[model samples]
Target: MGIESVLSEHRTFHPDQTFVDQANVSGMAHYEKLCVAANENYEQFWADLARELIVWKKPFTQTLNDSNAPFYKWFEDGELNVSYNCLDKHLNTQPNKVAIIFEADNGDVTKVTYKELYEKVCQFSNGLKTFNLDLGDRVVIYLPMGIEAVVAMLACARIGLTHSVVFGGFSAKSIQERIKDAQARLVITADIQFRGGKTLPLQAAVDEAFNLGGCESVIGTVVLKKSKDPIELDSKKIWWHDLIKNQSTKCDPVFVNAEHPLFLLYTSGSTGTPKGVQHSSAGYLLHAMNTMRWTFDIKENDVYWCTADVGWITGHTYVVYGPLAMGATQLIYEGIPTFPHAGRFWQMIEKHQVSIFYTAPTAIRSLIKASELNKESNP
Candidate 1:
């Protein structure tokens, strides 16, 4: 059997079926050749790909420049906001296009269109502006995968705020460490997360962290009311829907310097503490967008499924950054794969007809274990 068939045994959707219809290139060996060729002729490769995928405000005269200390600068002196390239240019052509498909633990699904996503992102950006959070300020987002999480991250990117998204499963102590390290002025979170048939008290954890006073320096906190039961808040907390929806959807994108700090993604330190890895906007976008286009071979009609949580760079890059930049239809699920059954992810694939499934090795192993359990039980 081929690799696609092997993947289909675990895949929620069938391969061969037109999941993703278009791409600039494909194949492992082909990608190896492309990468080797690009490294050999780096300038031409980046220049050609940028011209093909992105709408540049100022066409680049030079592609790769690494003179900046510890910084990789691509298309330096280019004057386009990364968010602008991702959203505005595509709006005219695919305004009504599906951008994000959200699947929750309770079997509920919601689709947000590009136009709707653009408006929501703008509103969230304006909401941040209302807090006087501007370029270079840090925002911490600890929310589940859904339209709001995606919008919040992009909104921070839109106005040049360096956002650090903490995984939903992280402990309060872990959350405090990131918030304190980023010196975040603002925080966005949901009251509770429904997963594995249990109510995860995310708000309570936030409250505990705040009580520890590690994040006392934060200027404001925003809460999204996902559940009906009201979650308590301090004088510092504000309602997300109340703060964002009223804002204008026409905020101009903030064009940042090429070497500006785009974000700080924390990884596990050898000593056990998480160390934040800083990334630059231009080069990071170039790498992420190029990978998305090639890896998924996504087209206009493709319903892409990136089965990773938003907390990891995988989700941040593939699920939000990569797919949205290309204007591909994306499916995001918020729960454990076995919450209802091992087949939950596959069910989503069948239901959404997902293409381009991306997930972690941990999950693959889990599914394999689940298959073993099913066989043992059935026998």
Candidate 2:
């Protein structure tokens, strides 16, 4: 089952003939020289990328200062806003480009262009201010994938709030633990999560976490309506639609120090205590942006898709930040792969014409197993 053994057995390979070969026309040979320079001077490599790849309000003079040992800082003296870097710079040319294509499990589809997304971010950011959220404040997002989930993250970035997005499938106690750890004052969630033809009460789960744990820091919960289920909202609960409806879409982006905490992500630990990890602003932003370009070969014309939920680090870095920073169109699905049929993933590729697709190995294996079963049945 080893990949090395399989390759040794075949002893055959073929180059990808259908590759568009854009690099051949665009300084492909010079890339090798750049690679050599990077290998020789990594500091200069990062510094050059920081300067050219992203916009900084106050550029850093120093590329890196590893004097602090394992905790190194890059572009330490710089100032920038993640929201501005991802949205503002692309407005002129890519205003109408589809930034996010959302497909629900129930066959409903929605698209948000760059211009519209920017406006929505601004509106929700202003709405966040209405909640009296200060800079560096923590906002816990418990919504499923869609425009609102995407907007919640960007809105927090726009206002310098630290958002912690809890995965939709987490248990009530798990959500309580993260909310308690972050001491987040605001909770953003949806009425329901639709997956595998089942309705999970995402907002109800948040309510249970709050009711049981009673985190005193929580001021109110913002709820997005994905289902028409009857619900009662206490004074502490707010409808996301109504909250942002009257808000203006003209909030200015907040610029913070390069090392300012962008967000906190909580992950399970074998020791049973969930660990909360924080990423710095400038370093993390540039890392995601540069890696998206060099690693994924993403371009303006390409349609990209990273099949991961925003609750995890992979989704946060690749699905949300990376493509957005590069102004690349991305497909976001709000369902499991085998929802309608086993061939759903392939159908999506044809439907979206996705050029660059990224997914987890578990999904790949699942597809392989399903295909083998199908072959056996047909044969």
**lDDT of the candidates, in the order given:** 0.81, 0.89
Clashes of 1: 0
- Model 1: per-residue Cα lDDT over 1-379, one tens digit each: 6555555355474445242233356345777899798889878887887778766666667677778755556877765577776788778899988888888889888988888888899988888898887688888898977888988888888899988988898888888888888898998999988887788877777777877777966899899898897566778898898887768988888877665667778994448889988877777787788887666677777888888877888888888888888888989888888878898888898989986688778887898899899999999
RMSD (Å) per prediction: 4.6, 2.7
Candidate 2's C-alpha runs over 4 A off are: 1-20, 24-35, 376-379
lDDT of 2 at 254: 94
Best by TM-score: 2
**Worst window of 10 by summed lDDT in candidate 1:** 14-23
TM-score of each: 0.89, 0.93
lDDT of 2 by residue, 67-92 (tens): 99898988888899999988998999
- Over 4 Å off, model 1: 1-23, 26-36, 68-70
